[model samples]
Target: MMIQRYNVDQQGVGQFDGGKITEQKPIGFPGEGSEVKRVGPLFYWAWAKAEHEGYIPLHPHQGFEIITYVISGKAEHGDSLGTRSIVGPGGLQVMQTGSGVSHEEGFVGSDMQGFQIWFEPHLREALRRKPTYQQFEHEEFHQIDFHDGVHVKEILGDDSPVALETDVHMWDIHINHPFIYHQQIGKGRSVSILVLEGRGRINETSYEAKEFFVIEANELEEMNIQAEAETRLIVIEVPTTVNYPLYRK
Candidate 1:
């Protein structure tokens, strides 16, 4: 299968708090200038960075499995569930907005960074269920550390406490030296790659920081990623086809 890459300029730029906070949206909505609106069950992806401590006011969401992954500093979450908590770097907060839910976010510490992603499931069934929320500390997630300076933290999958109706798997990977991370993505499924830092080569092609790519496979095969610089990236794998009726914008 072939791979496609979108540079930073190809994505959407969002500024809040009078530019105190900025975000790059790889899959933003219309008028956001992001050519890619979505991939399979993956609905949205936003890489947010805080220049100074700030917050986003309460907002509504419905029928989407949303997740926020903290990359640096600290993040605070509050929602209609009466949940209010703070999460440091490497932590994550997930919300399954079955019917509807409202939430607010605040980021503290200098240069705080994180990602907010939304995944779609069978809306009909999800809407019938109640909204749910959960937060995972940095230690609760499963991590694989290699002596070669390669590391992987599974954000989703069997070992993860996060359970979503969306058939997607995600991970945060890092490497400092020449290394290869491998995976076998089943046929008809695609991998969404976000290069958050440094540079690397995937399928023999070079890519630098702030690059977003999608790989579609014709069959199950090893997906090899080789990086030489100190790098950090995110990967989300989802089926190419939707099994249940999906909600359209």
Candidate 2:
């Protein structure tokens, strides 16, 4: 078992639209100065917020699966596929830029918060497929409330409608103070956890908001996380390696 931690100060920072939009990248592109770059198929992850209102001009993407998950407020998307859509809080906008596609983004409302994450598939196969776009409301996902003061919302995993070529599992979790959340990691897999709110402890080590943790196991392992205070986290699990060739930075 291996666990790596990255504090907020150690993450990468970025801005857009003259700083109208600010971002904290847990995993950024190469040379972005993030402690962690690509992890398995998980390429990039940015937690962004609109100070006021912001817009990102159309940009092209190819051979990657992009997901925009709105944490609060609203996000509008316009793509070269002639798709224009808006998703409110707890909604998601997914773009499979299989071959190639251009898209523009707009953040509506003050202090709008969201996450834009990129996942890589087999590039050669992805580049040969057609691009597509899809959207999902928050209620469409499977949410479970555990008796132990833990709530989990499945984003991309079992019982989720969102589908991509990448083999990954994602969840939005909230744990009440003094509660514990346990997770099992299968062999040859890794789990990345990002604290979005509150504080927590893992094996006597404390963690707070904006912190990222990566845990990998060569053999099946179990992890126990206890919430020091009310805490919210996003966790993604993926294979440690793939059979196909990976893009090197």
Candidate 3:
């Protein structure tokens, strides 16, 4: 087992709309200073917040799969495809920038919070496909409650409604005080975690809100975690190695 940790300040930072929207990036673009650049097919992960309101001007992307997941308020999206939509809390805005696409985003309501995650597929194949956009409401996802203060929501995986060409799995987890959570990780895979709220311990290491970590297992393994208080986390699992070529930035 290999474990790596990065505290808030150790991660990359960015802002849009003159700081109205700020981001703490666990995995950021090159030169942004995040300790971890890209994790397998998972390229970028930005946890963003709007203190009051903010907007990101139209930007172009190509050959990347992007998902905007709303955590608190709502996010309004406008794209070159002439699509206009709003995804509220617990919803998702997905975009597969196949050939190319230009999109703008706006944060609505007080203290809006969300994540913009990017996943990569084979660039040549991706660039040949047509760009597409879709939205999923909170109720559309599959969620399970253990009745022991642990709730698991599937964001992307075998049973999830949202599908992508990338080999990845994602979950949003919440655990209450004194409850333990366990996950099995297979060989040749890595698990990336970002603690969104509360305190917890992964194995023997303690962590708090805004902390980022990764666990890579060379063999089959199980992770034991305990929440010292109410805790919320977004977890992503991806292959440790891919046969396809990755972008060099």
Comparison by TM-score, 2 against 3, better one: 3
Superposing all C-alpha atoms, what RMSD in Å does each candidate have to the true structure?
Answer: 1.1, 1.0, 0.8
Q: Is candidate 1 or candidate 3 better by TM-score?
A: 3
> Per-residue lDDT for 1-249 in model 3, tens only?
888889998899999999999999999988787989999999999999997899999999999999999999899999999999999999999999999999999987688999999999998899999999999999999999897879999999998999899999999998976788999999999999999999979988899999999999999998877899999999999998898999986
Report clash pairs, candidate 3.
none
lDDT of each: 0.89, 0.91, 0.93
Q: Which stretches of candidate 1 lie over 4 Å from their true place?
A: none
Residue clash pairs of candidate 1: none
Once fitted onto the true fold, the runs of candidate 3 whose alpha carbons sit more than 4 angstroms away are none
Off by over 4 Å in 2: none
For candidate 1, write residues 1-249 as lDDT tens digits: 878889989998887777777889998988897978889999999999996788889999888999999999888999998999888999999999998999999977688999999999998888888999899999999999998888899999888989999999999998878787787889999999999888878877788999999889888867888887888889999998887876665
Cα lDDT, model 2, residue 16: 90
Q: Find the 10 residues in a row with the least total lDDT in model 2.
A: 198-207
129, model 1: CA deviation in Å?
1.2
lDDT of 2 by residue, 1-249 (tens): 888999988788998999999999999977676989978999899999996789999999999999999988899999999999999988999999988999999987778999999998999999999999999999999999998788999999878999989999999998886887888999999999999998878656688999998888899998788898999999999999989888776
The ten-residue window of minimal lDDT in model 1 covers 240-249
